[model samples]
Target: MLLAHDDEGSGPAVVLLHAGVADRRMWDAITPALAHTFRVIRPDLRGFGETPMPAEEYADADDVDALLASLGVTDAAVVGSSFGGRVAMELAMLHPARVSSLVLLCAAYRGLEPTESVRTFGAEEDRLLEAGDVGGAVDLNVRTFLGPEAGVAARELLTQMQRRAFDVQIAADQAVPGPAPRRVEVDPTAIAVPTLTVSGAHDLDHFRSVARHLAEQIPGAEHVELEWAGHLPAMERPDAVLALLLDVLRDDPTVHAP
Candidate 1:
């Protein structure tokens, strides 16, 4: 399938993948800085943004590989947020040669088993969406995914983005049916690529858990926690996130240094 993408800058290739509810547009805050040093390729994932879905059930890794191939990118470092991070993990495992490195933010992995809060929230959101209460779904998403300190304007923008995300999913003929689920188990030790896992200090506990798991299990993997941020640190703390990303790309030994 042909994927929709936005490419910028001119240097070593780097692909930025967005979270499930957000499209490639989520990278708008930090892409400019990254573009200064690398060729940035941002693609709207299937059922999200302008990207149309494939005819058959296709893994996200396959879509990513196809996208890079189409762009004539033989190798690249990948930066993925949330759902996109999960896809990056799969790509690192399935096609390590194409991926030069990996950076994951507020990524979800581990397993399908959810905590009590996650379960309750998921059920409620599903019920609201099923009852045609899209507004409620948007509100719940904003409150849950974003930090409480987020400004009203930011929350509204998030809601709008979510609405557009839902519309895109609905428009896709091959969108995944039913509720989105997580992997049963993710063995970071199986990943061969150099990896960097990042999480917001105020993010849900699951993200921290995943980051810790990756840091400990994946060889040479590094983990960083951003204070005063939640699930979307790249949005909430763009400067810090960009600095960390650049340090990782430059292979700086002391990334946390001020």
Candidate 2:
């Protein structure tokens, strides 16, 4: 299936990948800023957004590589959030030459065996969604995904994201699907490219822990913890996120000093 993408700007390529349940549209607010300095390619992941599900059973890395190749992108800096972060990690590990640097935001990497609190929250969310209580699920997700101190403005964005996720789920339900494969293994040490791992202060403890783990395991990976954000720092604090991303790309030895 061809991935739906939005491309803007005109400089070295910087690909943006969104989280699960959300589409490439999630990057809307942040793209304009990045567009001033770099070319951005944002694509909806398979089974989410406007992208059609692939006819073949493939891992996220495969989709990512295929998309990059389609764009004639031999190398680019990748910025991924949540599920997209996992794919970015895979890409860095499996095809190091294709990535100049990596930035992960509230990424899911360690595995599915999250802490009890996260598990409980996820279970409740799943139950609510499965029982057709989409509104309830969205409410819970906002509280779970955003920091308590997030501004009123951020809350509105959270609502928009929730609505988008619900629509994505509807699309997923209408498509032919099969059992997804288990999570793929990522060898952080194998990711030799410059990397940055970002975690929201209000994000699930599991995510924070994973970020720390990634920093330690990935060779020379930098870690940034945003004090007033949660699972989606890019959405809640786009300006700050963009600043850090640009700084990293500019200062990273692999990218700028090379």
Best by lDDT: 1
**How well is each residue in 174-231 modelled by candidate 1, as lDDT tens digits?**
3556334223235687878888888887888777777777788889897878777788
What does the lDDT come to for candidate 2?
A: 0.79
Off by over 4 Å in 1: 110-112, 171-186
Query: Against the true structure, candidate 1 has what lDDT?
Result: 0.79
lDDT of 2 by residue, 127-221 (tens): 99789888888788777776665578776766776666676656556567732533578888888888888888778889999988898988989
C-alpha TM-scores of all predictions:
0.90, 0.88
TM-score of model 2 vs. true structure: 0.88
Clashes of each: 0, 0
lDDT, model 1, position 114: 60
How displaced is residue 7 in candidate 1, in Å? Answer: 0.7
Worst 10 residues of 2 by lDDT: 249-258
Tell me the spans in candidate 2 whose CA falls farther than 4 Å from its real position: 149-153, 170-182, 252-258
Which stretch of 10 consecutive residues in model 1 shows the poorest summed lDDT?
176-185
